[model samples]
Target: MSFPRSATRSALALAGAGVLVLAWGGSAVAAQQGSTTVEPAGAAFSATLDGEATFETGPITVTCAVSASDPGDGNNLVPDEPDNHNPEGAVGGPINAPNFDDCEADVPLVDVEVEVADAVWDMSMQDGESAVGTMHVPAAGIVVTTSGVASCTATVSPDADVDIEGTWTNGDPVSSLAFDTTAPIEVEGGVGCPDDTEAGFTAAYEVENADDADTPITVGP
Candidate 1:
């Protein structure tokens, strides 16, 4: 999300990220139950659904009441390397797919189920313009199940990349992660799937330290 990818999860909000920011694969992103973060130098962090997290595909919109990163430990700063994603340093995320609850669809009587890939999603913080950097959903696809009016299963296949944007106020974790931009999501499902193959995702997550609930996650230089 808006935060460092290699850092934490708002979802911990994929742009539905809680960019939970679930990841593709490489390192894990940390969440609560003791999720951690090292900071600007580089570290893992955890986040939660600040307000709400949503996923839209075709005409169907999925709304989740709760979202969070898989709880774990990590987000410590890595030493500088010649060609690392995090110039200041890099920290492998300690996490998995964001968890969801109270989820429903814009369409009537439709139940939505999301199964994040099992394992630590990839979280790589990109080199930023300043102390601030950008965090995209680590990587991995979300398996979504729809039943009732809509009977079918869909997956945010292969690569789902979304950014978690922030206001840049001294780089502090906020109550929400604003995906300043939209990310494209790919889907593969049965005949019950939406007519269109393309889908869009947007969301905001409230980020914080998983381990230290009181301590706000911050990125510094």
Candidate 2:
């Protein structure tokens, strides 16, 4: 199955958001509950990224919703349960899933939102070391907004990481940012597409500004 540019944008958006959540998880400060805004200290640059993504085997497709929020307690970054939330949280919503061969007929995936209540982001950019961070989605849940047997809420532990290599400039950002995963991101909860499936993806984007550039990132199967 081929994922269009829009689907890739959604995938990258989720990955980008995952980056922030994991970065703050490493050293999140105390904040109010459900606070969805965080700017990491010593951040060389940041941007609202868009890209497409697909499940490696089933080709399950989705689009991402753009949003932002702050980090929460790093300790509770990886929750033991699903749909868990911290005082400050991250939420992706209103995603639509079209019918796939493996999916039930006319059972479109709708209102798909992944909520992370507790998460942590650990990042480093030392020489010979790729900038990387891991996020634990404690109480993470994916809600199928559509109505059908496939529309049930499924628990997902979206443990994701981001690795990039480029020269960092305060005002001048790198020309582009490349993203990849070392292994397949596994999704639990008996959901089709990603659940019980290995999802691997690679994305590349042209950086307009190091400080903050709204660039379009593209992902390929």
Specify the highest-lDDT model's number.
1
Which numbered prediction scores highest in TM-score against the true structure? Answer: 1
- lDDT score at residue 123, model 2, on the 0-100 scale: 23
Candidate 1 residue 123 Cα shift, in angstroms, is 2.1
Tell me each candidate's RMSD, in Å, in order: 9.8, 14.9
lDDT for each residue of candidate 1 in 1-221, tens digit (9 for 90 to 100) = 22222211121122221111111111122221222223433323555666655665434455667766644444322323322233345334434456666665534434445565554344433323422223435444455554444345444434544443333222344433443333444444454444334454455556555545455555333
Supply every candidate's count of residue pairs whose N, Cα or C atoms clash at under 3 angstroms: 38, 31
Off by over 4 Å in 2: 1-44, 50-57, 65-109, 129-147, 151-171, 182-197, 204-221
174 Cα displacement, candidate 1 (Å): 4.9
Task: Flag regions of model 1 displaced more than 4 Å.
Answer: 1-44, 73-91, 127-140, 159-176, 180-192, 211-214
**Model 2 lDDT-worst window of ten:** 16-25
Score each candidate by Cα lDDT: 0.41, 0.25
